[model samples]
Each structure stands twice: as C-alpha cells, then as structure tokens.
Target: MNKPVLDINDFPSKTQLITLSFQHMFAMFGSTILVPQLVGLSPAIALLTSGIATIIFLFITQFKVPAYLGSSFAFITPILIATNFGENPGNAMIGAMAVGITYSLVSLVIWKAGYKWLMRLLPPIVVGPVIMVIGLALSGTAVDMAMNVNDEYSFLHFTAALVTLFAAIVFTVYFKNILSAMPILLGLIIGYIYSAIIGIIDFTAVKEAKWFAMPDFLLPGIHYEFNITSSILLAMVPIVLVTISEHIGHQLVLGKVVNRNYIKDPGLHRSIFADGLGTFVSALLGGPPKTTYGENIGVLAITRVYSVYVIFGAAVLAILFAFFGKAMALIQTIPTAVLGGISILLFGIIASSGLRMLVENKIDFGKNRNLVISSVILVIGIGGAALRFSETFAIEGMALAAIVGVILNLILPGREIVQDEDEIN
Candidate 1:
C-alpha cells in the first residue's frame, strides 16, 4: 500500500499526524516489550503502562518535546536483582518508578545550579565509561539466559547462545534500514524457530495459555523489609543518575531536532520534573518507571517530525494496543533465543551510545588523567567492584562508576575545553 503524503514544513495534519504517530509507536514496540518479557511481568501490563506513561510524558512536558516514555533497559538489572531478593515484579517496578522520581528531583538541583556546573562534574569522558560499564555488566545476563533456553548442563546450548548473541551484534553493527532497528527481535525470532525445529522450545505453556485473558496487574504492595528496600534503591539509583545525564543529552538532541533550545527555554528543571511526574504516574498504575528513551530520539532524528503532537498521537495508539490482550499474547510466543539475539543488538547499541557521547564531545584520550579516569571507570564498573562503608553506603557497578566519575571530574585538575565538529558546525 502506498503511504499517505506528509508535509514536513507545516504541523502534520490530523490524519497524517495520526498515521505518523503509529509509526513511532511501532518503532518503540520491541524495546518496550523486551523489558516486561525479561522481568517476568505481564507483557500487556508493560504495554499499557508505557502507553499511559508516554501520554503523561507528553502532557507533563507540555507536548513540546518529541520524546516518549517507555521501559528503560537500565532498570533491567536492578529489577532482576529485586526479583532475586523476593520483591514481586510489580512492586519492584513501583520501587523503580519511585527511584526515577528521585532522579528527577536530583536533576532539579543540577539544573538550578546552572548547566555549566553540572557539565564540569559530568564531562563526556566520565559519562562514556560509566555507560560502558552499564552495558558490560548486563552482557553476562544476556549470555546466561540465552544459553539456558535448552539443557542447563549442555555445552551445546552455550555455543548456540553465543552464536545467537554474536549474530545480533553483527546485525546491529552491519545491518541497514528496518533490519537494523529490529536486530534483537529478528535474531530472537530466528533463534526461536531454530530451537523449535530442533525440539528445544517448551511450547506447552503457549498451548496451555489462553488466546485472550486479563493480564496480571500487580498493585504496589509495599513491605518495609530493609534488605529489599535497600537492594531496590541500590540497583535503581545508579540508573536514575545515568538516566538524568541521558535526559540532559536527549533534551539537547530534541532541541536541535525541533530547532528550539529546550534545555534552556522551558528549561531542564521543568523537563526533569515532567519526567518525574510521568514515572510517578506509571508506578501508581503498576508499570515500570518511564524515562526519555534514546530509541525514540533515533526515530525523531530519522523522521524529522518534530511536532510533540505526533508523539501524543503515538501515545494514544500505544495505550489502545495495551488494552488488546490478544495481541500481547501473540508477542509472548516469540522464542527466547530470538529475543536474546535481538538483545545483543539492543545492549550493544546502548554501550555504543556511550561511545558516541565521547566522540561528539571530542574527549581527549592522550591525556594521562583522561586515560586513567577512563581505565579506572571501565575496570571498576565492569569488574563489579564495590566500596563498602556502612551497610547502606555500599554500591557497585554503574552507580559506583557514576559516583567515581563525577568525583574524579570535579577533584582532578586538568580541564581543557575541546570543541567538537558538531559544536563548531
């Protein structure tokens, strides 16, 4: 079918905007679905919350920014940890949502202090390795789960998992157009089919599962268990910091795409507050906390459709699909191996996003201070080393990396300003 024509210069007409909006919704589907699937939550619930959160995001940001709120991959490890600690998936999500609100509150402080100060504390070099750590830390989980799709003790499953993972990475790096966007989903699909043909996938659940049913919507049932609360906070807070940093970078990207300085105009303070508000709303509804997703940023960058209204349109579509339980069940049938394959791309893309930050900033690698900082960050972050003070003060990986980076950037003396091609142009 021929697509309808779209006018780029003017605000998209109502019908045209509606169509384009669905494009955005489709664009976000894989990652949004990926999170809930990984966390053992109801896929329908994830979709519903994401749609609601995106709409909330649009409303809170005054529908000025072309960003959507969805499941943040950053929260996955924390969520997994919380689950391991016996936090119910829904409650864990609520805790994460609370942490997101905390993040936004912290950002308000940063924005109030002037961006120059915040930049001094979190230059590209510091942020790059911190983000790198986030990706490297999660790589193990991807490999482990991908392998477990078959025999727990068999080396063959491990080999297959590695192959699937490698395929996803290769596709993400080399594939073009639609394939690139769906590297993880495609890889998972292919891997699942291979597994099913080989008699590996246990589809008994799929057979027993109803064609349509009400999704489990677990409400927040807070328990004052210290370990659970601390564990959730420890896992959630680091990503929240990373998310805040990402928020600044993304807002800048949105401003450039929309040809307005959103960072300074409506101001980062207001935007962060809006993000917090969206997350809070998502939590109340038993969904994962919302964050400004980079995937949507890529969509905006490609389409050049800057109207916030289009995103609102997307939000509406997302919410509608959330209510369609039948469609949600169909998505669950996709094989785990295929999903693992897709994650290979998704995870690597996340890591590379960190690399791109440094490249764009022209962060110098030759300086001894720079090399030491980066090296320390990668080693500490990836190695899972933690500095323990009191029971509550101990932290690991991304959180640890972020804290060290900020401190080093501030305490260390060499501060040379390097202009980038983007900045110069």
Candidate 2:
C-alpha cells in the first residue's frame, strides 16, 4: 500500500489545509453541479447543500471516515420523473425526502440485524443491470443534447459534443494521477471553450449576475407546494437500494484507501445514517440527493491525503462557492450541447460500470437463473416497462426493474450454485 502524505487524523498547516481542501472541492464540483443542471434544480443549491451534507456526514461519522458527499447520479432519472422534467421539483424533493427516510430505516435494520440480508436481497445480478439501465435509459437524452440546438439538429453542436467526448476519453485513458480523476471537469472545460469559439455560449447571465448573492433555493411551502403520495415514494424510495449498495461499496474501498476498517469502526450504519441525513437535508433545501463522491475518493487515492479536516475545509469552500452568484451564473451559461457531449461519455461510463460490476463479481451467465435475472432487468428497465396504477402515477423504468429484479432473485433457485462453484474453485 502506498503511504499517505497526510494520515486521516493528521492536521496540516493552515495554508496546506486550505489548498488541499480547495483541491477536493474542485474534484467534486463538476459532477455535483451536473446532476441538478440535468434535473432542472439549482446548481447553486446543489453546491450549498452538498457542502452542508458533507459537514453533516462527517460530523455523524465522528469525522473518522474521510469521505465527501456530493450529488448522486443514481437519482438523476428518478428525480426527472418525479419532477416531471423539472416542472415540479418540489415533488422531487418530497420523493428525495422519502429516499432519505428509506435510507435511515435501512440503516436501522442494518444496525439491528446486520447487512447480510441486504446483500442477499440485492445481489450483483439485480444491482448490475439496474445500474446499466440508469445510464442506458438516459442514452437518448444524451444523444439529443449532443446533436440538437433549440430542438433542431445542428452540425456545429454535434462537432462540439464530439470534441468534448473525445477529450474526456483521452483524459480518462491516457492521463495519470489527479488528471485522470478529473476527466469530467477537463472535458467540460474543453467543451465550454469549444462552444465559446463557435459562438454558441451566451455570457449575458454571467455578466448580469451579482458577485455575491443567495443561491436560488427552492424550499417546500415557500417556492413550491409540498405534496407526497405513494407515487412519489414508489418513484424515489426503491432507488435507495442501489445507492445504499453504492454507499457500502464506497465505504469498503475507502477503508482500504485509508488503511482503516471504517465499516467496523465508524460502522456501516453510522456512515449510511449520515448519508441519509445528508440526502434528507439536501432535499429539504432543494438540492440533489447526496452520495459519497467517487471523484474525491480518486483524489484521496492520488494525493494520498486522508485528513477529515481537509474534507471539512472542502465542504466550507463549496458552501462559499454557492454564494458566489457570478460563478453560479457562469455555470448556468454552460451550453446544453457541451453538457450533452460530456453526458455521452459520462452516461456510457455509468452503463459500463454496471457491466464491470457483473464481470468483477463473476456473475455466471452460464446459469439459467443468473441469465434470466439479468435479461429481465435490462429489458424491463431500459425498455420502459411500467406498472401504472393511474394516469398520474406509475412504477416505471428503473424503479420497476429494480423491484422486479429483487423479486426474481429471491424466488429464483440456483443462489447456492455460485457459492458452491466458488467453494469448489
């Protein structure tokens, strides 16, 4: 294992702390803001609440786990569906609150009964295809944004998207260290520049924006009416299974990185409770759902800095950034085409990650049950199968697929086959 420059409890000088914290902030900024932008929430609110969420998470975990919380990509499609493509984000917020509550409940269960049951419930066969559906389901949106301008096909926009995608791929594949971890931000920067060169970016928002102002926070009962229903719960709460799985995976990897058994020390229940609290607060204040950021984890791996204080400092920085109205405006000015270009790569990576999960787990496609589980999940999820209770409500797409996958996994035989094969090997 590589030696860390700053150990988890090591405190650096003020200047060092500030700089390192800023680095962490920069690492998470791109994806953090991108989620809300895609789902039609305020990027400023995303930044602000993510900062708040991180602080809450750190505090809840006793600042022992050096993990940064940011916007969750897993909830992108769910958020959009709940909000009606940003038409009613308050509904999405309610759904997010439900997700947070679901997390808390799950944490309670884990605390009392242990997490082995969860693993049994959502095996790789169920989780992998659901993750794939998350990315694949958004493929059309990515393509549409990459190729269209104002709903019309544009050659120049397509060129810009291609350039952005190419840059991201190059950075991800060829670069080492921190640069490799920042492919999304680098691709966005390059794409933004290209869009500017093509005279597609509008700078009026940036110009007219104040230097310091409050982020546009959409609060329930203040900005939009708060409403909750079975539809909202059904739409959002089920995705918690995926995100919780993701959270556990992150904790395991982070434990390895920091040379600490975080799951045993801070405990999985504590980390998950913090995550739920973060998501709950973020949603209460109109930000995207918060999850442990992979980018910051990559940063930790590269920089070998594991200080929770550094993570704390970064959270502060993100909050301060949210108040920088001009910067927020600048982020808003980023063209849809540029975002589209990056989303093509970003979303594809998401889909590929699911496949990687299946491969890494050595999910036996040879098994009839395994094959059936994956097949049903992918087709139902990506094919947009829905269980409609009413015109206004339905469990469709990813949520529907996840529920179906879990049920199939539970009922299907051959669960012991993989375990038996592993034992024999």
Candidate 3:
C-alpha cells in the first residue's frame, strides 16, 4: 500500500478539513464517551482529556499521522479497585491521571531504546498470555455489573446482559462496514433501546440536566491514606506493557493509512514517547488516561483521509466542547441501566479482544505447557483471586495474569514448539 501525502501544506481546503474533522470526531464518539461512563469516571473530564490528548499527540508526532487519542478502557479495572479502597471518584481520576503521566515518562525511555528492545523484552509469548489474563481478570466484574442493573440481584438481569453480550459479538463478527467496526457501541445502543422499551430507563436525570455546564475540572489531589505502593506499582506495570502494544497498533494503522511508516521514519520510540506526552497532558487535566484510539484508525481506514490538519481540527473542536457545560450534562444524563447495557458490550469486547490476541498469536493450547499457563492465568485472573504479601505487594487479576503468563512461558518449555514465523513477524 502506497503511503499518501499527509503534510499540512498538502491538505485539502478548510471546508474539506472541517468535514473530515467531523468524520473523525464521529469515529471517536462512542468509544470516547463510553470509557468514562463505563468506568464510573466523569464524562466531562473524559471529553476534555480526549480533546487535549488528541492535540498533544499531534504536536508530539509533529502532526505526521491523522490520529486521535481518547480515554483508555484498559485502566478501568485499576480505577475500580482504587475506588473500592476509598479513593473518591475524583481522587481515583487523579490516580489514573497520575498513572498516565507515569506511563508517558516510561514511554519516553522505551521509545528511545527502539522497537527491537521492546520486542526482545516482551515477546508475543509473554504478551499473548498477559493479554488473555487481562480479559479473564475483569470478566467477573462484567457479569457482576450486569446483574446489578435492577438494584437487586437477579438471574434475569444476567440473562439480559448475556443477550446484550451475544448481540454485540454477532454484530461485530458478522456486520459489515461502519456497523461492524462499532459493535461494542452498537451493542450498547441496541441494548439501551431494548431496555428503554421495557420502561427501565430513568429520564429524570436527562430531564433535570442543564443544557450546558462547565466540565468539572479539579486539581489532582492524592487520596486513599492507605499506601499500597506495591499494589499501585503492580497495577501500573501491566498497564504500561499492554499500552505499549496499543501504541504500536495505533502507529502502524496511522502509517498504513497515511502511506508512511512513521514508526520507522520518526521512529516507534518517538511515537510511544509522544503517546506518553499526550497521557501526561490528559492526567494533568483530570481525564482518564489517553491513548491512540483504534476507533480513529477505523475512521481513517474507511475515509481514506490522511490529512493530519483535519484531525487537528477535530481535536480543537473536542477541546471547545469540553468547555461547554451542556454537552457534559447530556453525557451525565445517560441512565445507569443504559450504561450497564452498554457495559455488557464494552466489557465483553475487552474479553473477546483477549481471545482474538491468543488466536492471532497462534498460541498452542493443545500442548500441556500452553494449557496449564492459559488455564491458570484465566482462572486466577477471572476468578479474582488476590495474592497478598503483607499489603503493599498485593497482586490481583490482570497484574496477576501478566506475571503468571510470563513465569509459565519461561518455566514450561514447549516440547513441540511449532513456531509460527508469519504471526511472530
């Protein structure tokens, strides 16, 4: 695939840029808004960070690729755990933001070291299982949330969630074009509509919500007096590991769309560091950590618009919207059941994506070593078994999965190692 011209000087006219920008914005709409809502973070902050992150990403990448950064769903489990430990939602936001900043700083070092070093240290063998565990770890939370929609524990709600989950999978797996690309969002929409028809949606919040209000921006403050330094670090490491994969994917997509391998041109290290910078900015402003949004990659793929300027325009619009009070209000007005219904799709995707990773990596589950690693990783992670060393060194779920997978990969050497060079390359 030939790379297209993407320099700002070579972009289409202003009118064309605005139109393209709107398309990019729409691409990000469902995923960006849903991340905050699903994770119990403020939608307003999410919107703002997304906008800011997009701009910063462009600046750091020198506007080389038409990409937009948005709230990362990867941090949802960590945020949820932090919240449980008595971190206020706002404080949790601060913690997550801090993590993003930390990631950004770490990314700089990784980027400078180049992609070879990254691939060497974190091979597919390690990354593949870690990803599977991430999904497994959070699976219970998905079911738990699904069952809690009615404010009462009911098998009916779980059934409803399962239905929503399956519907999303079907649509995403089989649907063509834009619909196929947005199965998670589409699933939520479909589920919400179904719930609404059943009279489960509460319109009171929507009705009472102001037309506009300033997105609540708070200074980053430390909370949760209990210091689980080790737990926080454990949570932080796995996040960084997976985020690096996400970073690579985003850059590769942009490179393919724009007709340039910016990963090799400006370098993957540069792009990762750029992503870190964007994350740092997002953290400062009290938004969920930002990453290059794959949704935007789909948008670029479909539109064939490679103009970075247009993407920058979209970023500005997001920042402007962040300042608007009414937009945030409308986001808040989204009902819990509606959100829960959407979550059924979102969290399920998180799990399914993991399965995709395993299959794509050609992980040999037939082998005893493979089976043991995969099985233990899945059970411990999904079952939410916590491993504690006093308190600071507690490991649970995704972090546990990552560690277990790495350890198993090293310890249980495959007897029949059929290396799939194609996937590995």
Candidate 4:
C-alpha cells in the first residue's frame, strides 16, 4: 500500500500533510482523553494542557523532536489513591507537579553523572518489574470501568464493552499498515455508533453544550488550594522514575526512526528537562502529567512523516478541539463500557512493555538478587502494599514497590548487573 509520505526532509504536499496530522491526532485520541477521565480531571483540561505542553516541549527541545505531549497513564492509579477530592483534583495535580519535579531532579542527575548512573541505581531488574506492576495493578480498574465500574447496566454495559474490545482488536491485528496504528480511534468510533444505535447515549449534555465555549480552565495554586503530602509524593514519584526510563527508550526509538541522534543532538538532559517542564505545566492547569505519546511516534513510523511541523499542526488541532465544548461534551457521553474496553488494551500494553524490557535485556532469572528484587517490586505494587503516614497520606502501590526495590537492590549482595550494555534502550 502507498503511504502518504516518508522521511523528515521530504516536503509534504498540503493534502498529505493535513491527512498525516489528523492521523497522528486520532492515533493519540483514546489514551490521551482516557487519562483525565480515569482520574476525575476534565477531559477538556487534558486536551488543552496537552496542546500547550507540546508547544512548550517543542520550544524547550528547540523543535528537535517530532512528538506530541499527552496525558500520561502512569499517574492514573496514584492520582486515585492520593487525592480524596472527588470532583476537585487539586491535591492530585499537586502530587503530579511533584512527579514532574522529581523528573527535573533526575534530569539534573543525568546531566551530572550521565544516564548510566540511573541504570546503576535502578537497573532493569528493579525498573522493569515496577513498570510492569504499574500496568498490572490497573487491571481491576479497567474491568470495573468496562462494567461501568458499578453494578448498574451490567448486561448492557458488558455487551457494549465486548463489542468495543473486539473492534479494537480486529482493527489492530487485521489492519497491518497505517490503519493498524489506530485501533483506539477505530474502536471508539465503533463504540460510539453502537451505543447510539442501542440508545445507550444521553445527548442532553451535548445538546445543551455550547459549540464555541472554552474549556473549564483550572489553576491549581490560584483557583484551587495546592495540597501536598509526603506520602502522596512518594506514591506518585515512582511513576516518574518509570517515565524517566521510558524517556530514554523513547529518545532512542525516535532517534532511530528519524535517523538522527536525538540523544546527542537535543541531549538527554535537555529532552528530559523539556518533558519535566511540560509535565509540570500540565499539572498546574489541572490536567494529568504530560508525556510524549508513543502513538504519534507509531504514526510517524507508518507515514514516514518526521516533520515536527506536522506534529505542531496536531497540537493546534487539539487546542481547537479543547475549546469546542459541545464536541468534548459529546465525547464525554461515550459509555464507560467503551473506555473500559480500551483501558484493557492500553494498560496491558504498559505492563507488556515492561516485561519486554526485561526480556530484551536478557535478565537472568538465575541470579537470586535479580529474582528477589523484581519479585519484591511486583508483589508489593500488585498487592497494594501501603505504608501509611497519616489518615490522608500514604505511600502504597507503585511507589512503595519502587522504594523497596531500590533499597533491596542497594543492600543486597551479588547484584552487580550495573555494567550491563545499553542494548535494551
């Protein structure tokens, strides 16, 4: 099949450029919107912040990386656990800002010591399994969402969810070209059409919603009180650690795909700094933490359009969409079943990527230290082991697992895999 365009330097025809941009937009649609929905933040806020984030990310990186910023799935579980405010996610955003600062600090460390020290402190043995737990721990949430996260509409919801899941799988597996990169978008469309046909959608909100209304902007410090907690910080920061590792991988992948040494050109420290700054900005605006979208990267791989300009076009589209209240309201009407169906794949991908990290690194299970470290991290994270600080603050789930893993890796004897090659990244 003919692709739209390929190569970064190739001047794309106007029609091809617009098509490629929209493809990137839909490719990122499901996960980007889902993150805020999962954590009780505004989807409009997420979209708007992501647009602003991508622009800022581009500025910080000197427009070197052709990537779009979107809501990160890593913070979902922690946000739910850390913030008690149901509708107002002020505390959660504060916790998210802490995660970004943690990234900034890590960036500083990487600048001083280079990225190798990070591998030494948290190697694949610890980092890989913790990331796996991040995804696996959320399996229950996906199931609950698919079932409306409640008992209501059990039969109808489950059926709709099944249809959505099946459609996503079919689109992903059967459509092997550029289309394969868009299962989330396709499944969502299928869910929307199905729900409409079944009369499961309530359009009143959409009907009453203004087409040109602006997103409900949230200012964490000014509009809402910024609450901080050590425990919540602890719970959320580990996910930052995960994204740091992912940052390395993403840079490597993007560099390879674009045939440019991004790690050297933009430099890892600068890239991470930009990512941290973008994430912090997102949190300030009451959106989820921002991260580079792998979906857009996949689209780049398919279309062969490596132009950062194309990505900027997608960012503009996202901002426009964010300001369109009726469109966002319509999207909100999507059945929980639809989100549930997509979450299953999205979360599983996160877990599987971590497992792939271990496998690609050829982690030797025979090493008792490696075995023990991974075991502790996975069990604690998956089991929701909480070390409480007070009534409102507690370190549990991924954070607790990460702390334990680092301590165990440091103290345990016979764990000298620090000098391993960077073959995995």
Candidate 5:
C-alpha cells in the first residue's frame, strides 16, 4: 500500500497545527515512556529529555528535518548490564554520555573520510549480531518480571502479563490507524486494567502525589570510573556503536520520508552530531539516551503530515508533561507485568532488526569469514560470555561481541560476495 501524499511545504492554520501536534505526541508516547520503566530510570526525565532532544535535533538539521529524538531501545540492555538500578544507576548514563561523545567523533570522521568508512568499520555482519544480542540478553529479565510477583511466581501476575502481551501483539499486527501506531500504549492500558483487577498495580505513589510538584532533575558526571565489576560506564561504552549504526539507518529512512537527500544536504555528520549532543546533554541530566524515534516516523507515514512545526509542537508538549508532577506520577503507577509484556516484544524486535539488517544487506553466510564472525558474536553475546581483565575493567555481553566482531571482520581475509552493489551503494 502507498502512503498518502504529503506536501512538506503545505502550511496549516493554528488549529490544524495543534491537532497534528497532539497526534504526533500520542504516537510516540508509548515507546518513549517504556524505556524508563524497564531500566529503573525516571519517566519524567525520559519525557523531558526527549522534548529537549527533539528541539536540539531541529537546530542541528537547520529546521529542515522533521525528526523527534526519544529514549532508545538499543541502550536498554547495555544500561541494564551497566548499572544495578540501585547501586550505580547514574553510572550507566555516564557511560551513555561517553557513547554520545563517540557519536560526535564519528561525525567528524564522516565529514572528512565519508560514510563508507563507517559502513566498513561497522557493517551489517558486525552490527547485525550485536543488535540481536542486545535484545536476546534481556529476554530472561522480561520473563522473570512477568512471572514473579514481588520476587515470587504468581499465577495471577503471569496471567496479567500474558494477556497484556497478547493484546500488544494483536494491536500491532491487526489494528489499523491510530490504534496501530500505539500498540504498546494500548497494550499497557489493557495490562494495567487487568493488573488492577488482580490487585497487582500499586497506586499509592499516585495517591500520595500532589496536584503540583517540581521536576527534580538528577544531574550526571559526578562519580565516574572505568572498570569491570562495578563500572557500568565500561559495559555501556560498546552499545554506542550499535546506536550509531541505528542513527545512520534512520537518517536514510528519514531522507526517504522527506524526499530529500539528508545524507548529503544537512549531511550525516550534522545529523549524528545533533543526536550525540542530545544524548550527552540528556544523560548528564540523568535522562535516558535519545535517538531518532521510529514511532513518530510511522505517524508521518500514516497522516502524511511532514511539517517540522508539528513535531516541534509535540516536543513542547512533552516538556510540559515532564513538568506536570501528576502526569509523571501516573506513569509510575504502571504495573510490572504490563512492562514485562512490552519488553518481551520490544526486545525481540530489536533483535529481529539485526537479522533483517543481514538479510537486507544480502550478507553471504556461506563465506567462512561471515559465518565465523556472526556465530562467535551471537554465542558470546546472547550466551553471556565476557572477558574480564580486572575487577573494575572488563569487556563482555554485546560490547565484547561487538569488539570481537570488528576484530574478526578486519583480521579475517577475503570478502564475501555481494548479490547487489546498488543495495549497498
């Protein structure tokens, strides 16, 4: 099916602009908030960062690109591995800031060396498996949360989770229009309703919440260390590469959506630099790392509204919500079972993206180099193998897998045959 034709230059009245802006906001609401719930981060911070990041993205793209930055799924597992939620939660974000800085460096290289260099350094073969590992690693965590009721298995909790998962899947695959765009949110609604019915959701926080409260911001970059046992900063450093690959891919998709060669115009350098700065700034404020949102793009494709102003309008609304204590409190009331259901699907999709990357690039698995690299990375990553050097500094998980894949790709001789050069070109 073809998407409705949208004229990017089409100007709208204030009323239409407001309506479109709300639509944009609702479309991204589900996934944007989900990241914080899964990773033990503040939902308010997530909302606030996304809004600020989108505004920054606009500035970097010269107000020409219509992209909104939101909490990234790519960093979910890396963060989980990096921090223990209670003990060094801020450290994960500190590592995230480092990742963001790397993004800026990549932009500088692209400005001089070209994007093909990035493609070779982090190709589909390497990126594909690393992405898969990010998702697979967290699968167990999702399942455990769904089954456990306050750290013990409970049938009611399991049922609530199963129902929520089913609803999310159904909405994502069968529903159309606005409902289709908000599967995670809709699914969570169903899950929460059921969870409440079963006495799983605790609304005490919401009840105790005042009608108005200030947004208490948690700043980062205080205590930073580079180590293995307790250093989330080191664990999360490698995932930055995965996010960059995601950034490049998203820019190409955005170019297609806007019908402009953003890869050339504002250039990948500028686009990534914006995202890097967005992440660095957001992480410093204890917010999750930001990336270009796919949910917003889906909205663009659905409504055929490509106005940059509408997205800006949505960003403003997000910032407003972050300030609204009641809104953030309500988001906190969401049940663990509901979050588990969404995580299961969300994490799987992240993994599936890696597989799709390999297939789309037509990477030949028959070649010894390709097969060996992919297999080793997957086993090390998903199987949870790590190489620890010291108590404080070690490499493992997807990070280790990524480093190993890059080394193997570089050291391994002979190039696998490509079915089509134009696909890569």
Candidate 6:
C-alpha cells in the first residue's frame, strides 16, 4: 500500500483540517443528496442525518475508521415501493427502523457466533445477482426521467438527458484524481446548465428560499402518522441482506486503503452496528438510509489522507450546509431530465458493480449450481416475481429475490465441489 500523507490518528493543522474536510464533504455531497432526491426525502435531512451518523459511526468505532456515512442507493426502489412513491414515507420510516433493529440483532449474533456463517449464507453467487437485480430493476425509472416531461415524451428533455449522460460518462472515463471521482456532480452541473439555457429550469423555488432556515423535518407521528403495514416491512427488511454484504465489502477495501484491519481493530460488528444506528437515526428524522460512501473512499485513496478527524470535519460541514436554505433549494431545482441522464450512468454502474463482484470473486459459472443460483436470482428479482401472503403483505422484487437466493444457496447440492476446491487451495 502507498504511504498516507497523514496517518489515521494524525490531525492536520486547523486550517488544513477545514480545507480537507470541505474537500471530503464535496466528494460525498453529490451522491449523498442524490438518494433522498431520488426517493422523495429531504436533501437537507439527508445531509444533516448523514453528518450526525458519521459522528456516531466514528465514535462507535473509537474514531479509528476514517469513513464518512452518506445516503445509500441500495434502498431507492425499496423506499419508493414502501412509501407508495413517497406519498406514505412514514411507513418507509417504520420499515427503516425495522432495518436498523435487524442490523443490531445481526451484529449481536456476529459478536457471539462470528461472521463466518453469515458470509457462507451470502456468498458471491447470492449477492452478485441480487445487486444486479437492484440496478436493473430501476432501469425503467431512469429511462422515463430521461425521455419524458410529466409522462410525455419531449425531444428537448431527451436531448438534455443525453447531454448529462454524456458528460458523466466522459468525466468517469477520461478524468483522473478528484474530478474522476465526481462524475455524478459534474454531470449534474453540466445538465443543469444545459437545462437552464433551454428554459426548462424554474428558479422560482431558489429565488423565494431563505438564506438560512430549518430543513423540513418529517417527524414520525408528527408530520405523518406512524402507519406500519406488513407489505412495507416486507418490502424494506430483506434489503438489509444486500446492504450488510455491501458494508462488509467496503470495510475490507477500506482496510486495504488505510493499511489497517478495520474488521479486527474496530471490529466488524461495531462498524456494522454504527451503520445500522446511522440508518436508524436518519430514518427516525426522515432522511434516507445511510451507508459508508465509496465516493469518500475514492477521495481517501487519491489524497492519501487517512485522518479520522478529516472525516469528522467533513461530517460537521455537511451538517452546516444542510441548514443553508438556498443550497437546499438549488438542489431541489435540478431538472428530472438531468437526473435521468445521470441515472443512466449511475444505475448502470450499479449493475456493472454486481457483475464486477462476480468476476472479481471468480465465481464459476461453468458449474450447474452456480449458474442456477445466478439465473434464478436475476429472473426473480428483475422479473418482479412476488410471494404474496395478502393484499397488504408481500415479499416482492429484490426482497423476494434475495430471500430465495439465500435459501437456494444453502439447500443446493453442489457444495462438495467448493469444499473440495477449498481444501486443495
């Protein structure tokens, strides 16, 4: 591993801290706000809760892991399904609380029983296809936003979307260092400019917004009634399986970047519990589910700064920015076509990430069992297969796919080949 400019425990000068923190905040800003925007939650709330969650996460891990928490893309479809396209977000919050509790319970199990069994239960074959399903499932939504204006096809809107998508792709593929890490932000900016020039953007919201004001906080039982339905819970809970797997993968890669075994020093259970707690707190206050952001990780890898203090500073900055009413308003003014254009790349990257996971792990598709698991998960999840217990309750789409994948992984008969191969290796 390359030597870090600043080690994990080393704090930079106060001036340096502010600068680095802002940089870190900027790195995570685009992706962090995108989730809530996509899911019909408050961008301000997402920023605020993410900052608080990062503080909580750092404290829980003894301030050892230099990770910044942000909104998770994995929950986009689930949040939409649970909330009835954001009309009943309170139900989604209830489901998010359940997800948090589930994480806590699973953490306790890992603390007691070790995480090896958990790994076995969710190997690459199970995880990879489920992730693919998540991205593929949202492809239609992305296309709609790119091509349509209020459900009607508009040539101008489609052109704007294409421009945004093209910019994001260029940044992602051609740039290096910080710019390369922020394809989403760059794409949005370019798209916003194009939209504004085309007279598609309405700046009325930004103009009328206060410079400083409280973000619209959607408190459960206050803004919306706490209506917990079985269908919402079912829609949301199974997603934990994929997110947990994603968390573990991030920890492993982060350990490599910082040259510290985070799983051992801070402990996987602690980090995971922090993640769950962050999501819980974020949801309790009407933000989307929080996760460790890869964008910030990219920042760390590029900058070679491993200081947790920097991460903390970034968290603080995010919190402050959340109260900036004009900034929040500006984010809201972003055109749907622009978002759709960016989503084209973002969603495709998600699906590609899943396939990359399979390739990286060298999953043997030549084997019948392996092929069966992947095929079943992809079809069930992307095909919108559901196991409905009642009108009000059903495990459908990605959730159903994940549950079925795990079961199939366990009961399938080709375990001996892997075990024998393991022994040989």
Clashes of 6: 0
Model 6 lDDT per residue over 133-218, tens place: 99999999999999998789999999999999999899989989788878888899999999999999899999999999798898
**TM-score, candidate number 6:** 0.97
TM-score, per-candidate, Cα-based: 0.83, 0.97, 0.84, 0.94, 0.93, 0.97
lDDT of each: 0.69, 0.90, 0.66, 0.82, 0.82, 0.90
List model 5 lDDT by residue over 1-425, tens digit each: 35534455566679978888888887788888999888888888888889999999998889878898999987877787778654667777777788788889989998987777677778889999999988898899889878886789888888988888999899889977867877888888889888889887778888888776766566643444433244565677777778888987887787777676777778889999999999988887888899998888888877778888889889999888888877788888887877888888888888898999999988898898889999999999988887887877678778888889988988899854332323532
**Candidate 1, residue 332: how far the Cα is off, in Å:** 2.9
- Per-residue C-alpha lDDT of model 3 across residues 93-118, encoded as one tens digit per residue: 54555566666666676555545555
Candidate 6 residue runs with Cα over 4 Å from true position? 416-425
lDDT of 1 by residue, 205-321 (tens): 656666656666766555333234565567666666677777788888766666666765567777788777777776666666677776677766666566677777888888778
State residue 305's C-alpha deviation in candidate 4, in Å. 0.9
* Error in Å for residue 109 of model 5: 1.2
Candidate 2 lDDT over 1-425, as tens digits, reads: 98899999999899999999999998999899999889999999999999999999999999899999999999998888888788888999999998888889998998998777777887888899999999999999999989998889999989999999999999999999788988898999999998899999889988999999899888889998887888888888889879998898798888888888877677888999999999999999999899998999999999999999999999999999999999999999988888899999999988998999999998889999999999999999899899998987789889999999999999987784333211311
> How many times do residue backbones clash in model 3?
10
Which sections of candidate 1 miss by over 4 Å?
A: 1-18, 85-91, 150-182, 185-212, 222-228, 389-393, 416-425
Alpha carbon deviation, residue 350, candidate 6 (Å): 0.5
Residue pairs with colliding backbones in model 2 are none
- Angstrom error at residue 389, model 2: 1.7
